[model samples]
Target: MIEEPGRVVAIEREAVWIEALDEAACPGCTASVGCGRWSFDWLETPRRRRRIRALSVMPLRVGDAVVVGIREDFLLRSTLAIYLLPLLGLFVCTIAIQQLGFGESLMIPAGFLGFVSVWAMVRRISRRQMNDPTLQPVVLRALPGASEGQVRQAAF
Candidate 1:
């Protein structure tokens, strides 16, 4: 399971909406002390916070700290589907066009068509899986020390 710390921002009957905590920036590489990367500090920009709703089995309240997680297999499968499938489609289409002796002129168009088709297929599959539990993030556990009384008092 891949887990991240988040805070419950809202509560539904069976789910909690969480705001993920932004992790600290990574430490510098091997040449840290003398690295020139810091010179490009201006290039860095603040990113929008990610908010997600996760199924929870335990009682939760807004302001509660929690751990959210998703399966590793789910993460890997999504990464491959988004990045690799399109390239594979492009190459296969180009190769097929070449084999048919349609000339190089049609290669670009054929590859584009294949890429778009595969993207549409992937999109359809993902839409169908919008409610799939395996692909959805879940509330793994609540962090200790945040009392429900305290959260309730704070909510007002």
Candidate 2:
């Protein structure tokens, strides 16, 4: 499981909305002198606060600090779906258009149509996945210092 610490911001029935407590840090690299990211610090924008609605495994209060987790395979699959699927759709469409003896001028438009279609398909797949508990982030544990009553509630 990939875990991050978050503070519960709201409790809605079985779901808890968590605000991430950690900011992503740049990786220290020896090649920073040649990296554009190093020179773009002045232009960098602050990251927006990320709030995730995660499945609550135990009773929680709005102020509780807890650990949230997702499966590593789920992360990888989501990455591939988001980045690679559309590109594949574009290529496949372009090739199909060419093979069907369409004019070269039509290939670009066909590819665009295909990309949009696949993107919409991906969106639908994700919407359906929203109900799949295995794909959603889960509250793994409350951080130490939680009230004893909450722990006792979880134990049963």
Candidate 3:
């Protein structure tokens, strides 16, 4: 499981809106200390904060600091399906159509259509996958002593 520190922005029953604290350090890079980019990572962060709706397994409230976690395998699987599959589909469709004596124009369009079709399928698949517990982010723990008025601490 991969975990990150977040602050609860809102609560509606069992669902909680969490804003993950942005980290300024390089994320698991080989040259974390030596790389110049790692030392200046703050320049890449967006000015706006990003939030997500995650499950509130335990009692939570607005302004509570929490640790949220998601399974690593779930993320890896989704990335492969969304990106690699459609690209493979594009190449396969183009090559097969060309070998079957289709014109270059037709082959190109067919390849694009194949890529689109695969992408559509991936979206639908992800919608269903959303309900899976393994993929869903869960509130792991609530940080004690952190009040609603306190500024969120960045977790590396």
TM-score of each: 0.78, 0.78, 0.79
Decreasing TM-score order of the candidates: 3, 1, 2
* lDDT rank order: 2, 3, 1
User: Model 3 over residues 72-142: C-alpha lDDT tens digits?
Assistant: 88878878998999999899999999999999989999999889999999999889877776577888788
**Candidate 2: residue 122 lDDT (0-100):** 94
The numbered model that scores best in lDDT is 2
After superposition on all C-alphas, the RMSD of every candidate to the true structure, in Å, is 6.3, 6.4, 4.0
Q: Which stretches of candidate 1 lie over 4 Å from their true place?
A: 24-44, 146-156
Please estimate how well model 1 matches the true structure, expressed as its whole-model Cα lDDT. Answer: 0.76
lDDT (Cα atoms) of all candidates against the true structure? 0.76, 0.79, 0.78
lDDT of 2: 0.79
